[model samples]
Target: MNNKKIFAFVIFISLVVASILLLGKDMFSPYVSFEYAQAHPDKYVQVIGRLGNNVPANTEGKGYTFTMTGESDEQMAAWTAEAKPANFEHAEELVVIGKFSREKNIFVADKVLTKCPSKYKKENN
Candidate 1:
């Protein structure tokens, strides 16, 4: 191939690789256990689990904090700056996405999603 053609091909390949690497695990499956998240405090990860018995309470700042029980039965502290999610108290399953903060010893949540049970949905008799 000519120099121009070869250069274009290389650029195309480089762009493709960069996109894949830069996107992070979010493009694939980002869900992980609490243990893995704690191990990689600098990386953002998603953890899906049930709410522990403790209720979420306001932080000294503006966010709310609580404990979540991972599917593996591992527990971790989670804090979210957003207002306590609707139905948070009754959520059967919840997913928290954020990076663990070793300084604060908590998972600083960027997003919180709650999955309510079928009771919240309308039933057809």
Candidate 2:
């Protein structure tokens, strides 16, 4: 191939790689601490915490409202449009994926995953 053809090929490959990197960045959103999520309200983040003792209440067809407490004792209210998971009352931990709403001072979750404590315990002989 001529020098121009080779140069063109290299440029095309570089462009393709750059595009993939840029697009892939948005495909994975890392889990962040509650403090970080609160600081960056506009970005999507995943928060892992335990549900607070307060009972979760239904929100007029919008979703459910509950409180979540992080490792550091930082608590935040979270609302999820998704249906409540089975055995939610017995969940030992929760992983919530969504963004914070500064206006409402709550974490508006797109998805909610629950981890039940009893399900993972080994049977005693």
Candidate 3:
């Protein structure tokens, strides 16, 4: 290939690599601590915690309210405008994704993901 063709090919490949790196930077966000989420109320974040002691309560409409206990024992009030998941009570862990409302003192979740115990169930020998 000519010099110009080779140079253009290299530039194209470089641009593709850079674009992928930039786009994927925010694609896989790691779970944030409850404290961090609380502090950054404006930022959309994800928190993984075990289910709280209180039973998940149904809200006035179709929504539901629940609680989550963080790793350091941080108690967060969570509310979702969606029906409670069927496997919620059997979850070993919960991943709540949303922004915190500092004023309301609640983490309004956009989506709730339940980590079922079956994935980690012990098998008897």
Candidate 4:
């Protein structure tokens, strides 16, 4: 092939490689499971799970430590995390960004969001 053809091919391959590298990072991103969180307490993880039941109400004070149950029994694991205030305690879903702590047996979520069922409400109606 001519110099121009070879140059273009190299450029195309470079672009493809760069794109793949960028997208591939997401694939390597750590998935936070209850078991995983327990296994690796220090490594930062992106955890996702259901926000079942309030922290027994009258837990007392702000940001009481709590647990997040995974989706299934197999995935079922618990971690101690400083949850938000009482009003926000009733959150239906939680996505915690933190590391696991085996001794603590808690996720230690740095951030949490309550799933707003209102968002799923039918808008067309």
lDDT of 4 by residue, 6-90 (tens): 9999999999999998876644556667777677776767777765554442244555555556778333333333655444555
Compute each candidate's TM-score over C-alphas.
0.73, 0.74, 0.74, 0.55
Cα RMSD, each candidate: 3.5, 3.2, 3.0, 6.1
Find the 10 residues in a row with the least total lDDT in model 1. Answer: 53-62
Residue-level lDDT tens digits of model 3 in 37-62: 99999977889998887756556586
Candidate 4 lDDT (Cα, 0 to 1): 0.61
Specify the poorest-scoring 10-residue window by lDDT in model 4: 73-82
lDDT of 3 at 34: 88
| Residues 6-92 of candidate 1: C-alpha lDDT, one tens digit per residue | 999999999999888888556454789998888999887888888887655556578889999987777898898988877888889
For candidate 4, give the lDDT of residue 78.
36
TM-score for predicted model 3 compared with the true structure:
0.74
Q: Tell how far residue 45 is off in model 1, in angstroms.
A: 0.7
Q: Between prediction 3 and prediction 4, which has the larger TM-score?
A: 3
Model 3 clash number: 0
**Distance (Å) between predicted and true CA of 18, model 1?**
4.5
Instruction: Tally clashing residue pairs in candidate 2.
Output: 0
